[model samples]
Target: MRAVILAGGQGTRLKPYTAVLPKPLMPVGDMPIVEILIRQLQSNGVDRITFALGHLAHLVQAVLGNGKRYGVEIDYSIEDKRLGTSGPLSLIRDLNETFLVLNGDVLTDLDFLDITRFHADQKSTITIACHKRSVNIDYGVIHRDGFRVTEYEEKPVIELYVSMGVYVFEPAVLSYVDPETYLDFPDLVNRLIHKNEQVKIYPYDGIWFDLGRFEDFNRVHEIWDDLKPKILSHE
Candidate 1:
């Protein structure tokens, strides 16, 4: 399988740490997060990987270095200026077959082979890997009908299905993207919907985290002992 990993974000949320090191290069347990991702993909049968990079691109290339050590052939597509999430895809070439796209900073033990099979069986234009997350609301909520309160609930928990920044895409999907334009993943999905393309989601209940967030980054380190085994099982 071929995959494109998005590692270009400025990681503004991560601040000082990201100022010097790209989020993907940030250590999770002992190795960088992107290294874990590459190993996972390689073990799951992905042989070719491309990095879509911008900020600190040179550093990423320096650290990863052709992916030979990781058991995959690595290449890169660098953006001259900022291109929203999906826009970077326009810069990559030879994506004439089905491919996978995902964030490089994500930490997840999801089986790439399974998602690839799911996408193939469904014959979907795009498939997004999804995880269920429960968000806690601190404030009270109220329901009103023209200023008359009908119901109220305090500190409710809401469950939502969020994208894990992992995706399977058919090459045809690129038709909607205008080269060199700023386009985020959400906007691209909206466009796919407008065009009546088959866009689906694979619901996964497993280990997943966006290391871009400070809290999640800290949490990973807090449980590194346990996470290390599951995340790097192939290694």
Candidate 2:
């Protein structure tokens, strides 16, 4: 199977670390973030992979070099300019069959094979890997009825489902991606929904992290010793 990784982002959120290297090249555990994702994809039977890169593209190519050491053929699609999330896929002409695409900064233990199969079974044009997240408001949220006093909920944690930055897409979905413009994944999803196309979500209740901030980066380092055994076992 073929997989494409969106490694082109400037990762402004990651700041100093990204100032020197691409987000994908930032070390996570013992390997670079992109390397970890590559190993996971290989272990799950993805034989060929493509990197869609913009910032520090050469650095990524230099480090991952043909993906031979990792047992997968590595290819690249360089973006001369920034292509928001899903726009880079429009530049990869070889993607004819169903393929997997993901953000390079994510750290997850999701089973890629299972996601692919689920997409096939559902006959969905696009499938997103989703995670359930909760956030609590600092102040009380009041339900108002104009001039009437209503009940209020204080500091309640609200549960919401959000994209985990991973996706499986059939070739047909490419039609929605414009070749010359920057387009985000959510925009494509919205268009798909408007067109009544089948879009599926695979909820993952597993270990996952979006290493896009300094706090999360530090947290991963703190827990690396404990998580290494399990992560290495999978590799």
Candidate 3:
């Protein structure tokens, strides 16, 4: 299978560390997060992988080399400038088949094979890996009917399923993205939906960390001892 890993982000959210290294290169446990993801992909039957690169592109290439050590063919697509998220896909060639695309900064034990199968079986244009997340409000929440206070609740929590930055795309969907300019994946997905294309979401109920935020980055170390084994185990 072929996959494109988005490694181009400047990772502004991760300040000082990103200032020196690309977010994908950030260390998690012993190996860099992207490296772990690459190994996971390889083990899951992805033989050809491309790194969509921009900021500190040279450093990343230097660190990962030809991907021989990882047992997969490594290739890259250079973004002359920042191209939002999925915009970099426009720069790659021969995406004429179903492919997997994802952000390199994420840490997850999700089975890529399952995702690929789901995409094929469903005949989907695009499938987003989703996870349910909840956020609680610390303050009391209030409901009002104009001039009257109707109800009040303390620290109400809101829950929603959010994209985990992993996706499967059929080559036909590539037409939706233009050659250049800033176009985020979310925008592209929405555009496809508006056009009545089949965009599916695959719910995930396992370990995941974006590592784009400071708290999440720290959480990796806190959970590594437990998460590592699950991620490494093929069974």
Q: Give the alpha carbon lDDT tens digit for every residue of 1-235 in model 3.
A: 8999999998999988899899888899898888888888999998889999999999999998889999999999989988999899999978988899989888888999999999889889999999999998999988999979999999999999999999999998889989977899879999999999999999999988888878888988888988998987763
The worst-scoring run of ten residues by lDDT in candidate 1 lies at 226-235
* Per-residue accuracy of model 2 over 1-235 as CA lDDT, tens digit each: 9999999999899987798999999998678998889989999999999999999999999999999999999999999987799899889997899999889988888889899999999999999999999998999888889967598888989999999999999998899999957999889999999999999999999877888878877888899887666554566
| Candidate lDDT (C-alpha), each | 0.92, 0.90, 0.90
Cα displacement (angstroms), candidate 2, residue 34, comes to: 0.8
Write model 1 residue lDDT over 84-131, tens digit each, in one string: 999999998689999999898888888888899999999899999999
Instruction: Go through the candidates in order and give the clash count of each.
Output: 0, 0, 0
The 10-residue segment with the lowest total lDDT in model 2: 226-235
Clash pairs, candidate 2, are: none
- Model 3's lDDT to the true fold? 0.90
In candidate 2, residue 137 scores what lDDT?
A: 91
